[model samples]
Target chain A: MFKLLISLALLLWVNTSFAISLIVNDSVSFSPDSSKDIRNIFTLQQTHWENGNKIQVFVFPDDNDVHQQFSKSVTQMFPYQYRRIWDRVTFSGTGLAPTIVNSMEEMLEKVSQTKNSIGYIENIDKHQSIRVIILQGDENEAQ
Target chain B: MKHNKRYFHASLLQKGLLSLLLALWIQPAFAIELADNIQVHGFLTQGAFYTSDNNYNGDSDDDVSFDQTEIGLNAFWQVNDRVDFSVQGLYRKAGKVENGDVRLDYGMMNVNLFNDENNHFGLRLGRIKNPIGLYNETRDVAFTTPSILLPQSIYLERSRSLLVASDGGQLFSKHQLGDGWLSIKLNYGNTHNDNDEIRDQMFVSYAHGDLDSEDGSFVGQIKYNYQSDKYIFALSYADVTLEYDSSSRDLIPFADGTARFSPYIFSAQYNGEKLSLTTEYYYSENEFKDFGAYSPDLSPITTNWYVQGEYRLSHKWQAIMRYDESYLDKDDRSGKNYEAMGAPGHMGFTKDSMIGVRWDIRPDVMLRAEYHNINGTSWLPNADNPDRKETKRYWDLFSLQMSYRF
Candidate 1:
């Protein structure tokens, strides 16, 4: 019975953990030079592309499952931390916040349609123009 | 103009209640998005306070009083790629001290001068929020703070107007360093006028004259955030000056003086997924010169510090504990210098220990309750406790607040 319980707990943990990929629009040809660039972009530290086209970020809401995993796995930050950063910037009139979508499908759609936009999705859906950018480092060593 | 203030206060409280209902019914529409890329955001926070001995926010001597309220609305308009316009209107009532009034919180046009892959820089002109410590800029917003009352050792409530915002220019820059980001912000501006409360605190209501900041103040800060805020360290400095012009009809002898204050702060934080640790230290040198014939020039170096820890119990619940300390003069930690002049010895400093819990009912709504065990009257507003002698050396304060934002 103990072995069965342990196996069930492991299964539950595995079912909850999922891989998230960073997606960019078709107009973007270059990816982040380093892992820090990914964080800088999403955290509003980096606002423009190297070519000067402004980056319009789209993402799921803070409570969304995929968004939570993406923040911890892909961006290597907690959802609450991102929320705090966004709220501080927004209220203090320091910077702008990303457009929050409702679902992963909506995220995929927005990134594909918007120019120079970036977001994360659990898996690549039916999208011809949106490209998935492979992050450089492991999530554990991101800091 | 006599009954006008009471009428206005009543309306503001009504507005606060009205918006609270509106938030509950229409949660999504709280954030209004315009067609031309303009986004509107705001927050409403209502608090109830009860103190075991002293007064806070209202007549809270053993009675729950709902006198602290903050209502604000801000708009961000992306005018173009290089410039954005931001404006906000605030109505705050923080006790008998800060009566209800509609004031412009901040109105600025941030012009993006330059940006590239790894660096971004900007110049913000107009009325801007002063970047003090981590929570000064967004102090009034309840959703952004961990507890109802922030560490009063540094973010003092009496000097709210002087430290809140400035009407001048600010330059901000962010650079991506090796495995981290470095941000620097510098501000130079004249403080807005509202010195009656501050003057009363300093002179015990003796100066019935105008007290204002004639010279512009300067504030600058540099911060390095590592690993997307797993670790953070910051250094902030400010030089502020004020002048008090005494009137002939005052109660006490005429005392005209200039006060120069320079405060240096070092802040550090470690943010983990479930727990966070933060500590900040303040070293301030204050000089008071030329305050009449009898009063000698006095310069005191004040010291204050606080250490806090926050643990996330779950996705929507959080608990925080903090120990904050402050001294009017580091040399007179025991308040003997002031006791020599016939005053409560405990009034020279304050040591506060607080514990709080927060429940995020929804993404836009929050409920929080906190208790503070305080050992002095240093940071208490003079308006709340007019007779400082009646205050208890060891007192307890309890507060509850509900906040909604989008």
Candidate 2:
């Protein structure tokens, strides 16, 4: 009985450590009108204002690891890769890089205040002004 | 005037009221959501240049001048999941000319033929950079290379004569191979000069036999890039030939006097958190059919090499140094005899070294200052004295430039 209890405790620790949760505000809808692909959510330029009236975006700083991971998942590129792509685009006058914010709190605040702004966070439960977009599970039920 | 003032005041008041209402309406009618499509961005830069010696020859002593000031605009519109249209435009001053001539540098349309996880293929038409070396491909206003002065060996001043900036079309594709990438580009087309006199001269006098015709020579380039998180290396090869009208002009023929050039280059760069180093070297050979009747056989090979290093002192400042040298065949230098009588066998050598600093005042703006010491073993027409022979000359060059991008 003691062995079984210890094994259960270890399983719980592993599960909690590797838990992958995509945090969003509580009010965001997963329906088509308010829904978007991960690519669209990460790369979009403008968002609805936090007062829920207009559009704009909240961006990750250039050196942020979360931004790097987000870009990697969406564009399949690293920070430098995106930088080179953006550099070529900007230099040629074809597109611009995104605006950056410093911290997750800043990102959350901006996204909450400006409806058009969107950013990712590790902890979604603390923010009351936004809604989380439900992400479907993978074949392995990883999410 | 009073009536106009009243009208203007009324209009201003109306604008304020409309803006307030629009803000209010926008606040609630729209969910504070970001647009999933459409983007706006640009960059700007300004800088100055100074030459220690009056390098301008007979030109004015204003050793300092605006090095670069440019603005760019970019728009990317997603038509659908698989298709998007991208366009870019730029306005900047000429780099080599004495007068600060502002011109549209690039306006191109891009269509992503294919964009996959590990590979991408695209078609670009309009003004595009001739991708020769690492810097030439990204020499836009927003991308500042570590070197204050560009590598002159491969980035020749004469490249403009051979390559097109916006003219013609190019097909390019990149394939990702694990930690490396391979890119292939094929380009064809002709650039028509606005100046009739210059165009005619380039075709009839400057070009080799039958090269100046409507069918300009074809150019092809292959580049392989390998990058890990900290280090990067690139290898590239390019060949170009221009045809001239030999039958129409008074031509002096030597053996195999066709103007043909093949350049092979290798470059490597390493970047640490606070330091970066880059090195590049190129070897090129040019062949002439008949050495202006002076020699039945004359060929010259030019070798150029440079290494540069940079260290970041703080968040906003950096220091850099570079050494560059060009070695020409000392036997085939150009002169009145070489030009008029056509001596196919006169060549000279030149070497230059430079150091500089860069201050990033902001993300879109930077200030740069550099100094160069140049030494040469031959005499150029623009030198202090053309009649002097076997001379070594020295000069000091100073320049300051500011660059910004949006």
Candidate 3:
């Protein structure tokens, strides 16, 4: 009976702990701004930071679980939809696609080390190289 | 037998060249990183098509036809934060419609007049893709297209050359308005036209004439994206003018004339977690005068629309369905007046129903299969199927394609 209760608690903890949010290089010092503003950056529609520095975007592959979760929870979009947008603009010579990393660790390493870089992670850890920017609305809004 | 040998040799050369280009494209992406902001990308697509009755591209009526292939290589050099240069080279062979020749797709310089986090204004000079509709800019890229073929009602492949790109300039602006984003693009230029194919499709018979583009033609589109970019609405308009200079051919008894085509399209799309829906409605007016043999008193206005839905079945699979309709004359949907004029009634409209599935074989490779049930042959160009009078009213088509990108 005790083992069953402990297992159930562990599953709940795992489910609730996957809190996804935006993570940017330490150079950014913005608050919960408009979701539309962030969408433009991630989509490569917007390229410059307010300070006139080119914004580099890092992301995981389309099928990555955390990537999908971040897109849905933060941007309220499907992974394929986001990918299609990138393909349209990139192949058309109208815009560029974000740099894709193979894993979340690479995403963190790239986003943290590169200047003006932005990315997302689940349960982001507190680090001097990166800062977590809370999204404007409730993360559960995507549901 | 000589013609067959030439065709075989041409296909062999195409294969060898594409294989070499593919090898170059497969080089390490990190090598492109040597140049700070230079990015190179390319795509290769090959399709096999079979039809139940009528032909679609090549001899696809009863037997499988391998007449469609698209290859492209594009590069972008961000010279500076405020300026960039882009170029793309493309080779496409779609039956007689595209003659499998390498050509420059788009080569332009983009200068950002003003750019910040919230607002952007830019000017593009030289050859640029016509920003007419959502799919026109990247129509040749199979990865960017929703299906093996785009909805032909709005993006008719018959006159693709005239609508694809222009040698002129464009001005574009994007701004964040309250909770939404607004983007506007305007282009002015002269576009290239395939004279023989254009004449064949426009006039009943091939007119021995040269098609010339009138200067000052323009295209514009305004797009509003809201709801965190999940919803998009766009309005596009274009005015295309062509003048036919008749050649001295007794068999082609045609006089010099001018043709004007203007079209307006409204598009909307909604993206959801498991489903995405898209719809577009367009109205077009085409006017031709002083053709000697064929002339219309007034412009004929046509209407077309398509409703498409896609459902993501899993991480690697998707299902799609779309219904597309077009009428040559909105007021005469039955096409009786067209039939009375000695042309087949079905020539005035087209209705197509398509169902398809897509699988992402890998991140860089994709496989697609689709079936289409079509009524009417309005969109079929005479170049592909010369016997228009014998075209059946109802037909079915099936196609499969494999596409790779890097």
Please tell me which predicted candidate would have the highest DockQ against the true structure.
1
What is the alpha-carbon lDDT for the whole of candidate 1?
0.79
On residues B109-179, what C-alpha lDDT tens digit does candidate 2 reach at each position?
65656655346576766665566666665565535465555666666533543543435666877765654
Tell me the tens digit of each residue's lDDT in model 1 across A1-143. Answer: 00001010111111224655667766665554444667888888778888887777888888888788767765678999998888898898876788887876677666666677778777443222222552221223434
| Predictions: Cα RMSD each | 8.2, 13.0, 7.8
Candidate 1 CAPRI level: acceptable
TM-score of each: 0.90, 0.63, 0.87
Per-residue accuracy of model 1 over B151-202 as CA lDDT, tens digit each: 9888988778887888899999988898888999999999877877667656
- Which residue pairs show collisions in model 3? none
Point out the worst 10-residue segment of candidate 1 chain A by lDDT: A1-10
Q: Of models 1 and 2, which has the larger TM-score?
A: 1
Off by over 4 Å in 1: A1-17, A125-143, B1-19, B22-26, B340-342
lDDT of 3 at B159: 69
For each prediction in turn, the share of the native Cα contacts (below 8 Å between chains A and B) that it retains comes to 0.53, 0.24, 0.52
- Give per-residue CA lDDT, model 2, range A33-138, as digits (tens): 2212333333321122223322233556555666654545333345544444446544553333444567866665555443233455543333222223432213
Worst 10 residues of 1 chain B by lDDT: B1-10
Tens digits of per-residue lDDT for model 3 on B73-175?
Answer: 8888777668888889999998777778999999999988888877999999988998876789999999888899899888888668888887899999998
Q: What is the TM-score of chain B alone in each candidate?
A: 0.94, 0.69, 0.91
In the order shown, the candidates' DockQ scores are 0.44, 0.15, 0.36
Of candidate 3 chain B, the 10-residue stretch with the lowest lDDT total is: B1-10
